[model samples]
Target chain A: MEIPTQKKIEMLETMLLSRKFSDSLVELCKIQGKIPGMMILSTGQEAVGSGVCAALEPGDVIITNHRSHNHLLSKGADPKELMAEIFCKKTGCNKGKSGTLHLAVPEVNAPCTTTVVGGTLPIAVGRAFAQQYREESAITVCFFGDGAANEGSFHEALNLAALWQLPVIFLCENNLYAGAQRYEEHTRVIDLAKRAGAYGMPGVIVDGNDVQAVYAAARDARQRALEGGGPTLIECKTYRCRGHGETDPQHYQPRDEIKQWQEKCPIPRLSDELVSSRVISSEELKGMESRAEKIVEDAIRFAEESPYPEPHEALEDVYV
Target chain B: MQKLGMGQAVNQALREEMHRDPNVFIAGEGVGVSIHVNPMFPTTGLLEEFGPGRVKDTPVSEAAIAGLAVGAAEAGLRPVVEIMFNPFFTLASDMIVNHAAKLRYLSGGKSSFPLVVRIKSGAGFGAGCQHSHNLEAWAAHCPGLKVVMPSTSADAKGMLKSAIRDDNPVIFIEHMGLYFAPMPVPEEEYLTPLGKADIKRQGSDLTVVTWSGMLGPAMSAAQKLSQEGIEAEIVDLRTLTPLDKETILSSVKKTGRLIVMHEATRTGGFAGEIAAVVMEEGFSYLKAPLRRVTGPDIPVPASPPLERFYIPGEEDLIKAAKEIV
Candidate 1:
């Protein structure tokens, strides 16, 4: 699949924005002198989210795991409300009910993101089931980590999705770790995409750091889904630069491996590719970075200015 | 009015709701197949009537079934999925208890989760401990989910209609023992609103607080107690979570005596919740110590005679009522 210059530039801009958004969160935590509870960042895997989500249209649904800011941003989540949700403010997308770990933006069709490892897989299948049941043309994109593949629901969901020929793309961002447990040690399957064959769906592995590769694979899968062809499992071999959460000190990880993945940070890599290919100049790339930084700054300001929800507000959302 | 079994009434409700709303659909293992071709099974003839799109027969995947309902509910569709039996509910609890029950609250009430998880429960048919446990208390304890258990055919039809239309996740538990028993059901459309307790029988001597399978035994015990001039008021708590505390406390206030009854075992049964509610709100109204007529805290035995011995029966309800009276 040949990538268009405009789409390439758009992907670069999304990756830069997502990276800045994540960086702002870390900076905010530093200023607060504490990491907010249950905040998981997708630092080095920005390209996978940007690529896959860029392939999705407006009506497509997205279900992701705890490391979800990049996916939400790539799907066009309002950064202000997302940041406010992290700040536990009333203006947040979930009205302070779901913090960073369980953020959901319904307007962007990214409803009900979970922190549970394999929790989003089945839900994604159901979403696709609804789309097919209604005879709608749209599809669902489910994003999970390498650890989630080991969950029984992963097998169950893939089987059901394939059996029913539901319109869903199972995107596994293989970040090499399932919350401090190395993927290789946790599961015998080194290549998670190979497991998709057990369910009879096309399984493709892509260079997660290469935004173009991830985007092309997701676009083809989406096309197949729209054509009534069953679900596809696309495994993006990616890596997370930081500890599972902000608290870990990286005792379990090998320093050299972490250094290697960090060196391939997708944001700068995509920017360099766009510049070297003459699709965009170095000055233009610099301008995009500053623009992304400004948006992050504005989002932080909005989140900081938002008011905390009242104590009674906690009881309001327990039911319909 | 027509005499219909609980399963037939549930079928009527599902058929009516599915016809009324295009967004409504039902899915389960063998839902569309003929294994449960008995008329008493709710999904009988549903696939033929509604077609495969709405009546989905899934593989033996309970987690996916529950998650399918949760996801479909979030995506502007009302999915009424089945979890086969109560024990299989454990396999699906991560989705039911954790995801389906908590998603609405986690979304800050912005998302309306309109789905019904229908599971067959109770300690009859000698289905062993795995299949016959009444775990309504487990679902009733969850905050964002509504728990409903209908004892009569009328209630089965009426409450299911309300559950399907309600803008929340509802755990609709059907008693396996009650499925075959025919009861009066109105031909006209009617709904039994959730969170309201029905007075199965009105009397002043004592209040029999019960729900689901125990309602049958409690009513039988109520009939037996009337011979001795003890008029027992049976409070059937149709919905457990949005518990009809009003009716329970009112019955307790009137009778000044209460006996909580359930087929579930004594330990951590829903009876404890009713007993505590009465103790907290209507303690002064009590003339005698409140009693709990419940099964022993053990797995429901597989043997028919042993299971009969394990389940709380009319004898137990009568004994408890007599003691409280």
Candidate 2:
């Protein structure tokens, strides 16, 4: 479960980059008249994405949900194309058809993203089924929010995945709130990981903000899957700092609770860890932040310069 | 040539296609282990031949089944999924319409979805409203889906091969009533291409355009009409989406009259689409207004007598053809 110093530093860099990218989107929405489509920011839950994705190989497939910018970036999706997608430009990953809610980069082995809650779980099971059938030593990862655990598809997908012993890691990023509804308010089971037991799969819980904790759990779960040990549900106990979307108001969440969670921000915590462990100096950590900010700025410029797709292009990709 | 039932023809097609392509596989609820030791009709001997890996038996989770098929298709497998009946297709519509149909387009052509969904449809055997509905119109309305319904054994085999080979998602509708119905099928390999209509019977008086279960009643009516010297041309529209407008227009132009028919309710059946096409393109050639012989807008009742009244029969088609002519 021990991650090398270089890998830990890369994980920190990815987490920082995701945070900067998410913050930039919020800023851009304020300046622009509107964010192209629905935008769900994964601001506070970077460790889960960075940790789980870092554990995966290039051939591994990951299915993501609406709050997918972090997952895509952690999985090595191009920031420029993703930004172009957010702007609905023709140069986007999905040719401007799928906005923020549905961005996919097949080049990174992340083939699909869905806005529907719990939608990607079954598809992930399917990808794993294909991998198992082909006898390929690749695993499939599915990322979803707390709300998705209540969906019937989650139960079905887990059952099938476990029954077939398919190579799949069901990563539940429990971000405490599902579109303003608190996790406990929606589901009686506070621990989403425990639900995996019903399907006879190992259920592990991790401190989602702690990068090493999330990374260790993900590494173990992925290893078990790749070793023909069936699926595992690893619930990362996390929180979302911002409102659900750009239009959502801050009426639902308590201000003090938000402050408490923000105080434990993953980027700063990981940065502090990296510095204290002597993995890197404080100046090096500062340099990574600036580099991440520069990447986000360049991506915004690329997206702004890209042209909108012609109206006729909408009719082109429906077939083939 | 061999005489085979529609179900046997379908089974033959699946076996041949699986043998032909390594990526092709079948999955559904009762596919791997039939209640009886003997294999079921359409999936006969599939488990024994391919083993449980390819002939997968799944839980009664239609949504997951559909999503699994879509994902597997995207990941380089040609998956043929079977929904026990057509009405159950409603459970999987989200996956079919949103994911399977839209994947290729949403990916900007980076992905190709080659998935086939087979569902048995139509009213017969007192299966009740839940299991007896023919909802091909719903699938045809979706832009990214191809809808196909084959009536004969040969067409059952041929169209399925074509559907499996198709690069897009195909909704393959099989008629429960026609599953055991015997028909002639060739032993040689063939494919009934998508977007093409077949002329079941050629005549010059009036064109009877129909598909699936309705083809039987229409043919019966066409036979009865022939006794009275009315030669009705029967045009079987095998594929609903990417519809065979050329054959429909040409037939209507030659016959100067058109009667569109389907087993589904008249409210929003694909007959309206065919009627509109003829009205728009072959308006001047039509000697009479386009007519539709379809089931009433009520659900298929469970009682035999009521069901008989509910389903459109040969008499209805004959009456409609006589009135139109």
Candidate 1 residues A91-121, lDDT tens each? 9899988888889888889998998889999
Model 2 chain A lDDT-worst window of ten:
A30-39
TM-scores, in order shown? 0.99, 0.98
Q: What is the lDDT of residue B5 in candidate 1?
A: 88
TM-score of chain A of each: 0.97, 0.98
lDDT by candidate, in order shown: 0.90, 0.89
Give one digit per residue, the lDDT tens place, for model 2 in B30-123: 8878774532279978999999879999999899899889889989899999999899999888889888888788888888889999987879
lDDT of each residue in B1-325, candidate 1, tens digit only: 7999888999999999999999999999988895766999889999999999899999999999999999999988999999888988899999988898888888877787899999988887878998888888888888889999988889989999999999999999999788888899999988889999999999999999888888888898899999999999999888998988899998989999999888888888888988898889889999999999898989999998999899889998888777777
The candidate 2 chain B region of ten consecutive residues with least summed lDDT is B32-41
Off by over 4 Å in 2: B36-40
